[model samples]
Target: MERWVGKVAIVTGASSGIGESIAEKLVKAGVLVVGLARRVENIEANAKKLATCKGKLYAMKCDMTKEEDIINVFQWTTKNVSLVHILVNNAGGNPGTTLIDGDASRWRQCFETNIIGLLTATREAIKIMRDNNIEGQIVNISSVLAHSNWYFPTINAFDDGFV
Candidate 1:
């Protein structure tokens, strides 16, 4: 934590769940945090509770599935804050639908968010890190289903068969 003091970090899907938890942790650790999510208002509300931390939080509305949105977030963060020193790719979800019975769009949405979105964010973050010579850290939160093939009725689409 001491080492990350005064650094900058970006946490995607930060409106809730793991992304939100990571954002709060980073802020408390003295890292200026940029929280990106489609639900920017949620992150904005969270920022208030984290005011006592040493670092600052900026919530940006970004749809991870959109390349333009991801690009805009990186650009905005660099201009408003500083180069990224950490990136947590925590934006992802499955429709809880069966692969065979699933809507193609929903499957595509999952892929875009879990794979493409993470790559895009990582690429942008690396560019910033390279330009600024910051040896940044990246934490990708993967699904528990990544390692299993269980056939749960609810999370059928989340199994390794599709992961």
Candidate 2:
């Protein structure tokens, strides 16, 4: 079933893991898939494989933590594709540091990358989607740790807002 035929989708962190799986699913559904990630080589290599799939695949190098990079990805998509129909915000990871042993710098890094970066990307995506009159879906990949009551020091340090 080509449920996503003619649709455009951007999947961040598409270089590996769940992000990769999501991109593959979208591609199989006939969506034009742009895989964005910091690992340029990995995404590019994957894009080559996706080229033979049911949809078009474009791989772009993007550092989610940087505003310029995010903007560039959106601009590129707008320029080359008709519209963005979906955005998968899938570029976050646990730092594996407990609150008691983790330095303030590490804690800040997690918040910056997971929370701030996601917000920035979402804002830009919304702007583009709204301006183009494209009704799009934004899927944020959150961790189970965000809700679990287990007292992992690192997880506890994260703000509730991130959950």
lDDT top scorer: 1
lDDT of 2 by residue, 18-110 (tens): 888898888877889888888878877877887787887788999877888888888899899756888898888666676677767766766
What lDDT does the true structure give each of the candidates?
0.85, 0.79
What's the residue-level lDDT of 123 in candidate 1? 95
For 16-80, candidate 1 gives per-residue lDDT tens digits of 99889999988988999999999999999999999888998899999888999999999998998
Tell me the lDDT of model 2 at 104: 74
Q: Model 1 TM-score?
A: 0.91
The ten-residue window of minimal lDDT in model 1 covers 154-163
Task: List residue ranges in candidate 1 displaced over 4 A.
Answer: 153-162
Pairs with steric clashes in candidate 1: none
